[model samples]
Target: MAAPAAAISAPGVLADLLPASTRARAVARDAVLVLGGAAAVGASAQVAITVPQISPVPFVLTTFTVLLLGAAYGPLRAGLTLALYLVAGMAGVPWFTEGASGFGFPSFGYIIGFLVAGVAVGWLAGRGGDRTVLKTAGLMVLGNVIMYAFGTPYLAYATGVGAAQAVEWGITPYLIGDAIKLVFAALLLPGAWWAVNKFRSQD
Candidate 1:
């Protein structure tokens, strides 16, 4: 038999594609997703390059990973995932950028922002924001802006710099990279949805 119309029309996030036949099984699945997602973000955080002359905030893949995971996981799962990552890092897991831990770091605010942005993107994705290239692009941009909103002010406070200087140090140097990542996600997310639909149609 063909899949249900609701299933075809609204698959929700990518993770929703997984089957969970029982309540206990569904709970177990979500638990695994949260743990795995958090670990993925932490692992991505290590892929960083610091150009202190440009900014105290190192260029890291953490934001990209977090945003994508959020879209795929949906709000509750993504929020839990980021919460796990944040708490573990603050508790000295040393899984943060450059294997650093604790919260006083200049980039910690960005990490905090990740939790909020993850939830935001996941909420958007649940409402079909990630189903098309244009929507995905806009979603990614909003996620990045949310991060900067939280990150810049905290950076200023941590580094004892003025707001303008904080933007210079924390936001300016990353614009190009953020744009690149945004474009990549815009294309990749919609493409994944297309592929999934195509596969489902074939089945």
Candidate 2:
């Protein structure tokens, strides 16, 4: 005899919220989570903060949203969420940062990176990486590095700039802001877990 549905392990915040008794409900719940997560990411991308004379890339809230999604959802759903965002944007939805779309744009590299980072960070979170402040922060930094890994090279290629200048323009200007975002995400994940635990205990 198999264990009851409630005995099954819930890997992340989202899994905890969904019913595991049937495959159909699980599929529907995952679909809803992925769609909702994609919308949230798109909404965050629109909240861009521009800083001219520094770099072409503007600081956006997408990073924070991505990290949160990864921590809340697990790797597969998080990746799907980001993939949906990319596909929707490519299909002419102005959900990319600064209300832009299409595949040819240089910043789209970062968007691609978002998918990769979401998967990586979500995997980490699935393993309890986001349960502690230090571990969560480290995972957030890993996500940022993954984002820049794809972003910086494509930035150089797209802008017709040399490698050095690409670092200056695409990577350097965003370091401080990324660090701040990293810290914020790090704190937020553990705090959310604490709140979730507290609520569960009360229940």
TM-score of every prediction relative to native = 0.96, 0.89
Model 1: lDDT of residue 24: 97
lDDT of 1 by residue, 3-94 (tens): 87567655799999988889999999999999999999999999999987888899999999999999999999999999999999999999
Locate the minimum summed-lDDT window of 10 residues in model 2.
8-17
Candidate whose lDDT is highest: 1
Tell me the spans in candidate 2 whose CA falls farther than 4 Å from its real position.
Answer: 1-10, 13-15, 201-203
- Per-residue lDDT, model 1, residue 25, is 94
TM for candidate 2 is: 0.89
At residue 157, candidate 2 shows an lDDT of: 87
Off by over 4 Å in 1: 3-9
What's the C-alpha lDDT at position 95 in model 2? Answer: 86
Return the top candidate by TM-score.
1
Model 1 alpha-carbon miss at residue 132, Å: 0.5
- lDDT tens digits, residue span 18-117, model 2: 5656988888888999999989998999898777687777788898898889878889999899999999999998889978889787677899899999
